[model samples]
Target: MRIAVTGGAGFIGSNFVAFFCKNHPTDEIVNIDKMTYAANPMTLEFLEIYENHKFFKIDICNFDEMENILNGCDVVVHFAAETHVDRSLQNAEDFLTTDVLGTFRILEIVKKSKSLKKYIHISTDEVYGSIEAGSFTENSPLNPTNPYAASKAAADLLVLSYLKCYRIPAIIVRFTNNFGPFQHPEKFIPLAITNAMENKKIPLYGDGTQVRDWLFVQDTCRAIEVIIDRGKTGEIYNVSAHQERQNKQVLFKILSLLGKDENLIVQVPDRVAHDRRYSLSCEKIQELGFEPVFNFEKGIEVTVKWYERNQQWWKTVKDKDEFKKYYKNRYPGL
Candidate 1:
């Protein structure tokens, strides 16, 4: 099988690449990535030795370039997008271009291809906005509160439209927040860990009461592999670890794991239109023989240890002037 993966250099994308390379050793993988600020080539460095793995540094918005590279691939998993909520809130143009328009370009190519077997779009549970009381099912109406979520929701609808109008075997899998290695330091878990590592204050937005379902990266990778093989066309699957916890709870856990004092946490201004809670009804995906084997406590420990031991790996980027500027811009008062 030939598989073309966009955004293969990003957080979840890089992890998925390693997962695919190990599980599908005989399959050809063409990893097309834009190599954005969040992506590092070192993540996929070992895969260079494998004959079945190939990397192409290209932007997905360039339809002509993507069309040329994706030809003859049996499956195209579109994971490319500008995912940071704070960045999107600051400026939505990038999200619209990369998340919505970029996806349209990929779908256009797949629409004309006869060799394509499936196109799996990686979506987030944030499209449903927030649920303070219960979980959101796949059929729930999309009420995206933030620009990033709205852009992803738009792409999701576009994918469904192609399925209906062009008869493309496209699938969408909406996953909750994922945490593990190779994740950018700006994200919640990594940010907290890295901040604690340097004895810096961990920024907590909006009272730190926001709730989220945290899923390990490996479990999400395995689920995506299953979806590529067994997921039905034009279907949306929701996957979660059901490890829902408030932001403060998770932060305290990080501090506890690192043997740090809780006084290092500071309450900061909240994100624009921040959702209070996000939960997903993963019954549909679970019905397809999906399960999350990693418990939250264990996963957090492993993740904390990884960052604790790899200070050099993260320091190279976190200590950079570029990242410093962005970080300051994102958290001005902090």
Candidate 2:
């Protein structure tokens, strides 16, 4: 099989590429990434050794380039997007351009492709906004609270439109929060792990009570593989591990794993329009023989150990001037 993966250098995308290449050595993988700040080539350094894997540094918004690269691909997995909520809140234009327009470009290419058999649109549970009481099913109406989620919701609707109007073979999978190796330091899990490792203060938003379901990235890769092979077209699948944790709880776990003091935590102002909780129903994907391999406890442990052993990796990202500036601007006195 010939597969094209967008954002293949980003966290979840990179992990998926490695996982797929290992499981399907004979399959050809064309990795497309814009090489944004959140993506480091080092994350995919080992993939260069894979004879069947190729990398292309191209933005998905470039229609001509995307069309040419994805021409004969049997599968196009769309994972490219400006995905940081905080960054989106600060400047929404990037998110809108990359998440919505970039996805449109990919869909356009898929609509014209005769060899494309499957177009997988990776979505997020944040599109459902927040659920204080119960979990959101695949059919739940999208109610995005932030600009990032709104952009993704728009892209999701666009993918579905192509499936209905142009008969494009597409599937959407909304995954819960994913954490593991190679995640950017700006993100919650990696930030906490790295900061605690550096003996720096861990920044917490508001009271740190916001709830999120944490799915291991490898488990996410497995779920995506299952969906690619067994899922039906024109369908949306909610993939989650049901291992929900409060922000403070996750931080505490990280501290425990790293033997750090709780006093290192410093609460910052709450994010604008921050959702209090996010939960998803995984029944749809589970029906397709998908199961999560890592619970939060095990995943968090593994993630902490990875960060501990790979200090040079996250440190390089944290040491960048761009990251320092963003961190200072976002946290101020923290």
Candidate 3:
């Protein structure tokens, strides 16, 4: 099978690319990444020697370019998006352009491709907004709060529209918070781990009481693999580990694992419109024979070790001028 993975250089995307390339040696894999600040090429550098793996630096928003590359692909795994919530608040336009427009462009191309079998759109649980009572199922009404979530929600609706209007064989997978290696340091898990390792103050937004369901990146990728192979077309699946924890509790766990102190955490003003809690009901994906292999504790240990051993990987990114500017502007005292 020939599959095209968009945003293959980013965290989850890169992990999926590496996993797919290794497991499907006979399959042709095309990785198209825009190389955004969050996308690091080094994540997929190990795949350089693979004859069946090819990398293309193309934005999904570019129709002709995306169409040319997506022509004969058997499947399109859409993982490209501007996913940072804080960054989205700072600049919502980029999110709209990349997430909504990008997905639309990919849908248009996939609609026209005769060889395409399925299009899996990777989405986030945030599109369901803050769920206080219970986990959000695939049938939950979309109530996106932040600009990032709004953009993804728009894209998700667009994909479903194509499925209904054009009969495109598309499936949407909405996953909870993902934590693992290769994630940009700006994210919660990596940020907390790196900060605690460096003995720097880990900034906590608000009282850090916000709760989120965590899914290990590998488990998420495995779930996606199952969905791609067995999921019903035009269906939406919620992939989650059902592991829920408050932001402060997660910070303490990271600190304890790193032999650091909880006092290292500093409360910061919360981002505007921050969701208080989020959880996802994975019954849909579970019914399809998908189960999470990585438990929360095991996943945390593995993730911490990855950051500890791969200091050089994040060091370069942390030292970049752009990253510095973002840190200076966002956290101020960091």
Candidate 4:
């Protein structure tokens, strides 16, 4: 099978490329990526020797570019987006353009590709907004609180609309917060790990009581692979490991694992309109015979070790002038 994966240079996207290439040696993969600031071409350096893998540095918002790449692909796994919530708060325009409009452009091309068997859109459970008491099911109403979630919610609706109005074979999967190797340090898990490794203060937003459901990247990718092969068209699947923990708890876990002092944590003002909690029900995806293999403890260990071994990779980006400038401008006073 020939599969096209957009945003294949970014964290999860790059992992997906590696996963697909390793697992299905005979399958051909066309990686379409925009190579944004968060995207690192070096992530896929190991896949360079794989004959079945191909990379195209192209933006999904450009219809002609997307069309040219999607010409003969059997499936399009759309993972391209500006996905950082904190960054989105600082600059929402990029999120809207890349998440919403970019998705529309991809869907438009899918509409024209009659041979396309599936279009799997990688989404987040943040679209369900904060869930304090219980998890959000697939049929739950969307109440996105931030611009990032709102943009993702909008793009998700567009994917469903195409399924209903145009009979496009599209499926959406909303996953929990993902962690593992190769994640940009801007994200919580990597940020905390990297900061702790460097003996720097790990900034905790607000009292650090906010809750998030965490899932390992490889398990999340496996679930996506299962859905692509077995999920029904026009269906929405919630992919999670049911591993919910408060932000403070996650921080403590990372600190304890690293044998670091808790005093290094610094409480900072929370992001604008930060959701207090997020959780999603994975019953639908579970019914499809998908199961998360990594528990929270094991996942964290693996993730922490990965960051330790790959110091050069994250270190290079962590101290770059552009990365530091963006962080300073975005999180002023931090």
Give the top-scoring candidate (lDDT). 2
Candidate 4 scores a C-alpha RMSD against the true structure in Å of 1.1
Worst 10 residues of 2 by lDDT: 41-50
Cα RMSD, each candidate: 1.1, 0.8, 1.0, 1.1
Candidate 1 local lDDT, 126-222, one digit each (tens):
9999999989999999999999999999999999899999989899999999999888898999999999989999999989989999999999999
lDDT of 2 by residue, 1-334 (tens): 9999999999999999999999999999999999999898688785777788999999999999999999889998889999999999999999999999999999998898999999999999999999998999999999999999999999999998898899899999999999999999999999999888889999999999999999999999999999889999999999999988999999999999888899999999999999999999888898999999898898999999998888888888889999999999998976
Compute the lDDT of residue 16 as modeled in candidate 4.
88
Off by over 4 Å in 3: none
Off by over 4 Å in 1: none
Taking all chains together, each candidate's TM-score versus the true structure is 0.98, 0.99, 0.98, 0.98
For candidate 1, the per-residue lDDT at 28 reads: 90
lDDT of 3 by residue, 1-334 (tens): 9999999989988889888888789999999999999986567675687788899999889999999999899999999999999999888999999999999999998888899999999999999999777788899999999999999999999998999999999999999999998999999889999989989999999999999999999998899889888999999999889899999999989999999988999999998988999988888788889999999999999999999999988988898999999999999976
Model 4 residue 101 lDDT score: 96
Off by over 4 Å in 2: none
Overall lDDT per candidate, in order of appearance: 0.91, 0.93, 0.91, 0.90
